[model samples]
Target: MEVNNRYITITNHIQGSAKESDFELKVVPLRLSVEPGSSAVILKNLWVSIDPYQLNRMKRYSSSHKTVQPAVRITPGQPIDSPGVARVLVSDDPEFVKDDLVEGFVHWGEYTVVKGGMLRKLDPEIDLPLSYHAGVLGMSGLTAYAGLFEICKAKKGDKVFVSAACGSVGNLVGQYAKLSGCYVVGCAGSRDKVALLKEKLGFDDAFNYKEETDLNSALARYFPDGIDIYFDNVGGEMLEAAVANMNTCGRVAACGAIAEYSEGAKRAAPNMVDVIYKRIKIQGFLAIDHMSLHSDFLSTTTDYIHNGKIKVQEDISSGVESIPSAFIGLFRGDNIGKKIVKIADE
Candidate 1:
């Protein structure tokens, strides 16, 4: 079967802040069936995650220190891919069957044919929404789990600080810290996100960073005794503040720097004096590097979801055409939680 598949692609390598104009939706002939005896599958994408990290991949090649190299760059006139949830339409792969739901790297399109590389079948019996696989049960969830447990080594009674608290990874990190009996505080860009962090996600406290005149003073106010664990997501001024206010031997899990993604690599210059004095340790990690812990993350997070210990919120936009706007919304802080684009219904 052949179908007209609509996919999103970059017009050119992006520069500075990304705009909806930077993307184009194109339709191409798509084969809906796998070739005979080939270990390939045809998927109908249901939910696609729009992440800030993707902005790094859209940049033109540069030797400058400011540019971020994505795992894969978006070539002109080619489909842009992201971690997504899909239903198998046709399969020659032994691990997947027709109608089976799966999660992996999928393009921002109505349909896609995947050959290989890390596709996992999703449990149809799971009570949560399939879209959750693109967010809380997916990359963002694993990122939080690995960063918090493996990197930060968070413990009970630790004072935790999470920047970008209402974001996909940040929200989960705060909730996980709370589950570990830590006092968690999160910072978001808006008042509503701040409210959601404290009220819905069960963070001990939350603040709107946009309203703060001085980030250092704000951190000092929130963590009078100093923060024991800092989950650094937005790594500009927030990182500087967190480092200055870190307690002795504090752990800093450097997950991402969304602030630098658009602002041309303006990284926070942390005070080396404070780092030396407090003996603070900062480590950067990628979720893919910690795949060994994926099973543990899925099992534990699924339990937390079922028991009402972890809550998920997704800002979903309908249709493949909405992908550009949905993605551009990330930098604007237009999303309250995980930003997703729904291409089809299960």
Candidate 2:
């Protein structure tokens, strides 16, 4: 069968903050079949994650292109590939049969065709929302799990601070830290987001960064004893503030720098003197690099979700046409949790 697949693509490279005008919805015919003996798999796209990091990939030049395979720059007029959940329509790969539910790199479209690899077949019997595969139970969860446990080594009685705590990965980081018996504090862009962090996500304390005039003073007030772990998501001045308020031998898990993604944004300039004097161990990481922890992360997080130990926050929009706006909302701090676009019903 052949179907018209609607997908999103940028009109040109975006250097600064992304505007909705930069993207265009394009339709093309897609064949829902794999050639004989080919390893190709055809998928009906269901859910696509809208993340701030994708903005970097749309830039003409990005350090991301050199960092991770998934972060390669997007060419104008090409379908944007994103982390997504889909149902396999046709498959030539033995690993994936027809009607298999899968999660991995999929285009921001109604359907996708992949030459095997990248895709992972999900358990058909798993009792969870398929949309979760595109967000909380997928890359966002993995990013949070790996960053907190593996990179920061979060432990009991530790004082943990998460920047952009209402965001996809940051919210999960705060929840995971609290479950680890740590005192968790999170900072968000809005009062509602801050409240969600504290009331719903179980952060010990939360504050609206936009209301604070001095970030260092805010961190000082929040963590009088100094922070043991800083999960730096919104870098720039926030990172500087966290570093200043960190305890001796503190650990910083640099998961992302959303604040610096736009053009001419100030790069994180945490005090090197404070870092050295405090013996702070700051490490940058990508979730893909910690694929070894995927099984443990999935099992533990799945248990948490089932047991009501963790609150899942998902801000989802319906339809593939909403992709660009949903994505642009990320930079505007309009989303409270993992942002996802529902392209099709399962």
Candidate 3:
């Protein structure tokens, strides 16, 4: 059967801070059935993840596009691909069947047709909410898990500092570090977020970065002994301060650079002298690069959620049309945790 599928797309390549006007809602005819012998699977998207990284993809020219194959530039008027929790409507792949719940790279639309790799069926045993599969249990969770454990090699007694600690991946990194017997400190944009980080999320200490006049002073004050591990989500001056405050042989997992996403924003330039002398290991990583640890990440994160060892913070907006605004909110720090757009109810 044919249906009118409404999806979000850009009207032009965004140069700076994304406004709602830069995005346009486009509709097209979509077939719900897959041709026999075709590998395509039709899905009804339920929950779509709104991320800041998409801004880079929306730009006319982005260095991120050259970093990885998946970071391809998004063309105007094309449906943007994003991770979502969906229900399979029709499947030509043996691994999926009708009504199977799936979490994978789906378009920002009411429905999607995908083929080949990147799509996976959800585990039946995991009783968490479907939205979790789009956030903490999804790419965001894998990002946090891989960055902290694999990249930074977080260990017991380590003093860990997380920038943008109230964000999707940063918050999880903080909690995971704490669970690993590390002292965790997180920095957010507001006092309420700081309080939530400390009180609700079990962060050892939390501070509002926006309130600080000098980031170096703030980092030095927070990490009196110097930071052993730095999980950097916001780059720019935060990274510079973290590098200066890092202990000898400290490790830094460079995640997202939300600070440098806007037009004319200065890229991070940490002191090379400090880097050479301290032997700081700074590594940038992508979640897709660490799919080898997917099973372990899922199992461990699931256990954490079930045992109440981790608390999930999600800011959800309703409907597909809310996607652009939800995405724009990330740059503005308008979200507390993972910002998700609910496309349709199950």
Candidate RMSDs in order: 2.1, 0.8, 0.9
Note the Cα lDDT for every prediction shown: 0.90, 0.92, 0.94
Model 2 lDDT vs. the true structure?
0.92
Clashing pairs in 1: none
- Candidate 2, residue 3: how far the Cα is off, in Å: 0.4
TM-score of each: 0.96, 0.99, 0.99
Q: What lDDT tens digits, residue by residue, belong to model 1 across residues 4-74?
A: 99999999999998997899999999877777888988999999999998887888853332433226677
Model 1: residues with Cα > 4 Å off, grouped in runs: 62-70, 263-265
Candidate 1 CA-lDDT value: 0.90
Best-matching candidate per lDDT: 3
Query: lDDT, candidate 3, residue 39?
Result: 88
